[model samples]
Target: MNKYERIKAALNFEEVDRVPISLWMHLSENDINPKSLAESQIEQTRKYDFDFIKLMPFGLYCVEDWGAQVQYYSKSNQPPIVKKPGIESIEDWGKLKVLPAIYGTYGKQLQLAEHVSRKVGGETPFVQTIFSPLTVARKLAGDRLLLDMKENPAIVKQALEVITETTINFVKANVNAGVDGFFFATQCASEELLTEEEYKIFGVPYDLKVIESYNKETFFNIAHIHGDKIMFDLVANYPVNCLNWHDRWISPSLAEARKRTDKCLLGGVREAPYFDGNNKKIRDSLLIDGTVVEIGNHVKESIDSVDGKGLILGPGCVIDQQTPERSLYAARRSVYTGAHTLV
Candidate 1:
């Protein structure tokens, strides 16, 4: 089967010629320009012949036009950072205007996706990365969000409405750009960040709205719960067809997650060499330093978990810019060398 058919089979839990495989990382140098970014993603996808192309524009592109200040390192291996936040006080939340989905940073990424879509055509499945609405709010407000959500629930909810509406419009635009689905990441869903009750009120509702907007037109939607101690069952039960989290570092290993949700699982490789998932600082560095053999083992173990059914081999999050291409090649080739012992 081809990459597109292989991914669809995995989503349906049908037999695949081999487990579908894909991996993605940031292109620090070219991510600022849509043409360059699209070229880099296409090159990387062809180098390893990944089953899907998960478009990786600037990580903070979702919040840029909303007034969040960013600092670009201009280094080939370093992604951009939020130097200053858009929301300083509870009142600043009121200032966020619903920017057009085709303008600013968001517009640039839409162009990248459009380029990738036209290039890949229908041969390979491709997905766009989108943060949950609550995640976008947290990026804008930082730590002040917890307090605002408590003391100023109404005001916070209104801002979330703006964020959600904007995100839904973006999703619609991406679907029209010919993406198969989304890598819908929720960076604020973990226990270290929000309580179950708090997320249920703030995170889930807006997240579902952004997702439900395009679920019907997409086939490879992945609900990526981004940290440890996550509200797993809550997000896993989403209307999406797949679930992804840091299965290697966090709780509920791939075998365990398989027991709870019937959705396809998309992780095996580790993005950071040493992450305990406590939101701890790792010397301000995050990258995959694993050897090719270790990466092969990650693929081996991931396949053994679900007998290779409903699985897509990749890291829990984006891999590093400097992560060796050979490591990714190993991950993509391992599926051919090994097969799951289906029960």
Candidate 2:
């Protein structure tokens, strides 16, 4: 079956010719320019021949327009780091204003999206990465986000409204860019970061607003609950159709998650480490000679939990940039009817 047919069947919990598999990683070195990032993403997709493409827009591009001091990295494997956050104090929240999604850093991403859509429009589906409003606020304020919510909720809520508006605008722009869906990622929906009560107050309302804005037009939306101690019950009920998270590394294994939600699950291969040199690290009880992605039938076991329907074989999160090509080939081949070998 074609990519669209395969994805549609999996989304509807039907038999697939081969389970859809996609892996994403930050291409920081090429993400600085729109054309550069677009070309890099196209190249990466062709290299793996993935089932779908999740646009990697310089991990911190969302915060770049909001006064974030970003430090770009030159290494292909290294991610760009945030030098300083936008919101430093309660007063800084007052300084926040709604920005246009089609200008500045987000504009560059829009161009990247458009370029990708034009190149791979009908062949392979692509989704843009959009952080939840609360997640964007957390990325802007850093560690003090929770404290600001408690001590100065009124100001924080006001800021969130502005952020929500911007996110909604961005979602609309991406929809116009011919995106198949969005990978709606929420990094703040973790117990280590916020309590259930706190998230209900600050996270849920804003996240829904941004998601429901384009939920109708998008066909392949995935709700990604980032980090550990996740509020699975909370985000599992989001309007999105697909579920992605740190599955085996955190709570609620495939069996448990299937019992809770019927959203097409997107994980199986444990993310291989970033092997730059010969520092072989043990992961998933496998001795990696730096050339494998979950070298076992782990994919089969994950699919068996859902009876091989409504599942997409992939890494829990973005794979390490330095993960070897042979490893990715192995992961892609794991979903097919053959020995997981590189041709």
Candidate 3:
């Protein structure tokens, strides 16, 4: 089967020629320019031959237009840094006016997604990355969010409502740009960040609204629950085709996740060695400095972990830009060598 059909079969828990595979990372320098970002993503996808293209525009693009100051470095691999919180006080939350999805930073991302869509055509399944409303709010407010959410609950809820509306509009704009789906990432879902009660109130509602906007419009939607101690059971049932998290670093391994939900699982290779998960050292060594043979063996282990059904081989989060090119090539080629095991 081709990449498209292979991904569909994996999502549906049907037979696939091999497990679908993909990985993503930030192009910090190139991502600042629309054409350059498009070119970088396309070039990498073509080189590695991933099953899907998860568009990696800088993570700060969603909040910069809303009065948040950001510092961009051309020489660095790190994402653009936030200079200060957009919300300085409780009143600042009320000050956030809804920006049009087709204007400012949000509009620039829409253009980037459009460029990627037209270039890839239908050969590769591509998704636009969208941070959850709470995550965007955190980007704007930083640590003040927790204090405000507790001290000024009403005002916080009001702010999130507007954030949610703007995100829904953004999702619609991306849909118009011809994206196959969204990689909805919730960076603030960790228990260390918010309590279960808090996330149920602030995160889940808005997250569902943004995701539900694309329900009938796209089929390859993925919910990426970022960070450890995440509110897993809550986000597991999100309206998406696959669930991606730090499975290699956290509880509920891929095998355990299969019992929690029937959704396709999209993690295997850990993004790095030190993250909080089940097999940190082993996964870390493989991606960091492992031989081609070792990388291929890890790929086979990931596939077999899920019994090769409803699984897509990938890192829990984006891989580093410094990762060896040979390791990536090994990851792509491993499926071919490991395909026989699934039979």
Candidate 4:
């Protein structure tokens, strides 16, 4: 099967020729400017013949459109910064301005997705990333948002309503721009951070609304849980066709997740402490010696246990830009080889 066909079949929860392998490459402005990262991603996928290419346009820019300040780091750094917590009080919320264009960080991401999609066309499935409404709200409300959610429930609900509406519009624009699917990432709804009740109240309902809005014959959707092992069941119940999360850190292995829901499983690799060196250095020597190989082996073992069905081998979360590309290459190769053996 071609890459597109393979991914499409996997997304539908059907057995394919083999397990589909994909990566979420979050490119920086410098990488996008030179078009090197995007091009290299396409080139590498073509060379390795992987199953899918995630067009991970950063979602932080969506908050920036609401007048939050962003700080872009060097070419190898993830860009994040102090955002103006617009919901100081309920009255301040009314003063929010709608962006004339896709301003700030999100606009840049939209431009990159357009460029990459045009270049690759229909060769591979292009999945765009967007944050859940609660995630965006937390960024806008800062630490105070959580506080408000507990103390002043009415105010937090009001803020989330506005953000959810804006998110719906943002997602609609992307779907219209030729993105094949939406990788809906919800980081703030973790069980460690928010209780199951809180997630159901604030996160799940709003996010499910957004998913229902964009879910169509042309566009697919996946709910990505970035943290909290205990929240696997909650995430699995979300109204999405696929489930991507930090499997290396969380419970419910691919087999468990497959039993929990029929949705396609999209991860099995370790994230932090694996990608981030202990001493904060950028050298592979700092990583747990043989960490990459161990992870590759883990992915292979996981797929073998599942007989390479209902799985898409990948990192549990967004791969750190500083991570050596060779590590990612090794992970993909390991998954491919393991699946071929099963065949």
TM-score list, all predictions: 0.93, 0.93, 0.95, 0.85
- Whichever of 1 and 3 has more TM-score, that candidate is 3
Report the number of the highest-TM-score candidate.
3
Best by lDDT: 3
Task: Find the 10 residues in a row with the least total lDDT in model 3.
Answer: 275-284
> What C-alpha lDDT do the candidate models reach, one value each?
0.85, 0.84, 0.87, 0.68
Candidate 1 — which pairs collide?
Answer: none
- Please provide, for model 3 over 1-343, each residue's C-alpha lDDT reduced to its tens digit, 9 standing for 90 to 100: 8888998899999999888899888888778888889988899999998899999888998888889999988544677889976888899999888878888889889999989988996888898999999999999999889999999989998999889899888889999999988999999989989998999998988888888899789989899999889888899888888999988878779988998999999998877675345643434546778778777777888888888999998899988887889889888898885332232
Please provide, for model 2 over 226-254, each residue's C-alpha lDDT reduced to its tens digit, 9 standing for 90 to 100: 88899998999999899998885677887
Ranking by lDDT: 3, 1, 2, 4
3 versus 4: better TM-score goes to = 3
Please say which candidate is ahead in lDDT: 2 or 4: 2
Tens digits of per-residue lDDT for model 4, 1-343: 8777787787775767767776555666454342565676678677667666676554456676676766666355555555455456656555555443265556666665677687876888777777888888877767777777877677666667777777676666666667788888888767678888988898887888778878773445788887764577777777777888877656777777777888878876655553354656443321123455665666677786567776777777766666666666666667556422322
Which stretches of candidate 4 lie above 4 Å from their native place? 29-44, 83-90, 97-104, 217-219, 274-296, 337-343
RMSD per candidate (Å) reads: 3.1, 3.6, 2.7, 3.9
Provide the lowest-lDDT 10-residue window in model 4.
Answer: 281-290
User: Which one wins by lDDT: 1 or 3?
Assistant: 3
lDDT of 1 by residue, 8-62 (tens): 9999999999988887878888789999889888988888888898888788898
